[model samples]
Target: MNERRKLLLHEKVEVRQLEEGLGGSWHPGIVIGVSESCRKVRYDELLCDTGKSKLIESIPVTGAIEGLYQRPFVKSNYRGRIRPRPPSPEHFDVKTSLSFGVCVDVLFKEAWWEGVIFDYNEGGDERCVFFPDEGDERKFKLTDIRATLEWDEFSGHWRERGVWTLVSLAKEHKKEGHIFQLVKRIWSRLKVHYGFMKMISEWTCGAYCLW
Candidate 1:
């Protein structure tokens, strides 16, 4: 993989959007043009709120690059289609038994991130959760934490802490399917613009090489 591969015009890439406490999220865009002797790129990013494309120009080349996957950073809404159903309150109560060192998934940037509870004040509503992968810790409400779960494809249910929860895994699977379909549509458009072989090469190499 080469980090020095020159970014060309009309390429699909993602721009990094940094957050205050949370590390960051990548938003997808298409290279529309280049400037400053090709040190910067002009691109169009989809507006999650308006359902329209917005043109952003002169983004540094280092800021915009290919992503691990060709999908938008959807917030709240799933592919701008529907909001994912939160874990049913009737099924499990996270707050009553919340404690330190308990494994849970916290909803952040519209996705479930695995983290372990590090501290919690009894009778308080928030708990400190540590995300080891990011080497970061943050506070979250009980409503945002769900029991750490693994999908059991064979039995078609979610396993909480290695035990069966009996909740259908269909919604999670459906969300994943929606993302795959959206990526396929974007890939088709890129192929038409860049041709199959070139698109494959650029995509496989990826913008992550720069970092």
Candidate 2:
């Protein structure tokens, strides 16, 4: 059954935060009470602050249907953790056949990361695709792949998220210098090795000439 139908009372959940300063964050919560129709629920919003979590009883407000309620989507993996949930896979329709070298966003470590499909197996009910990112190869179900797109800030509209294939994740990783650092380290090691070998060869030639 789907997540909505399977959600029951007392089950832990991660509620999406829509409020200011906490927008886009997924906060830990639990189903404390359920209405007769099951359309409405009273859940406790576990306030997460500085690695501490405290529960606050959900109270229904007048004329507000979304009061202290959420769609109980993914199960809560929170142990005093608060971070934005990855973009919903439902946003993109994967109708086309995924082939090798196709750039796609992968749900890795609870975040949508840029990845390229290297290998694929379509025999099973859920197609398994391999992505080798940062020298680590891992298999992911087809459902976990989303079309790579970037939000166009210049447009100033939510619907303007565009697919600029040439610079898919370039701007996003500018602040993260680890990739540049890794490349620099590899280059430094190669330079050191080359210098050492050149010095040894010169010394050997000089010794032979003197003999």
Candidate 3:
């Protein structure tokens, strides 16, 4: 048997975004993956709200590299005004909206345990117990999470450019309900994009690299 190879901290992280969505409809925004060492990457989906309608906006994935070993997380704030629709004499229903945002320090960690052993007794025999060590485990943590909205523009697609600053972990709180809601919405969108069967096929073989 070959010994398991340990991966470098940075080598264990991955980030990717959903390829579909009209900027604001909750597409895959950011995905971060980590390995046992704590190396991580964040992939964010950026949306620009052009003056045009929300349906015609383009959202793109932006890449950011973060290393916790370098420094502590910082906080950032962003503000902007957006016209949900193009200005027109007939478009009296259009409204101007102001967006305020903040981004704070986010942290991630991962760990794994391999080849753990267990012991057991057979036939009521006190000495008949043995265990083998074999398995792997992983974990991830995000802290000081925040984001700020800067300026929003609408051309053919929606675009929002902003400055992201890390914040203090003291202000962070876990919102499992909100997280679950967002995840549910994203999964709904994914199901619509790819039907049940196709989604299963792609998830098992294509997107997740299960095959």
State every prediction's TM-score relative to the real structure. 0.36, 0.31, 0.15
Worst 10-residue lDDT window, candidate 3:
128-137
- The candidate 1 region of ten consecutive residues with least summed lDDT is 75-84
Model 3: residues with Cα > 4 Å off, grouped in runs: 1-144, 148-150, 153-191, 194-211
Q: What tens-digit string does per-residue lDDT give for candidate 1 at 71-114?
A: 33422211111111234658755443555545566766655655
Each candidate's number of clashing pairs is 0, 0, 41
lDDT value for model 2: 0.37
Better model by TM-score: candidate 1 vs candidate 2:
1
Of the candidates numbered 2 and 3, which has the greater TM-score value? 2
- The Cα error of candidate 1 at residue 1, in Å, is 41
RMSD after CA superposition, every candidate = 18.5, 19.1, 24.4
lDDT of 1: 0.44
Model 2 lDDT tens row, 61-168: 221122223433321211112111233547544443455435455655444444444443545434333222232346777677665433211221122123222122
Best by lDDT: 1
Best by TM-score: 1
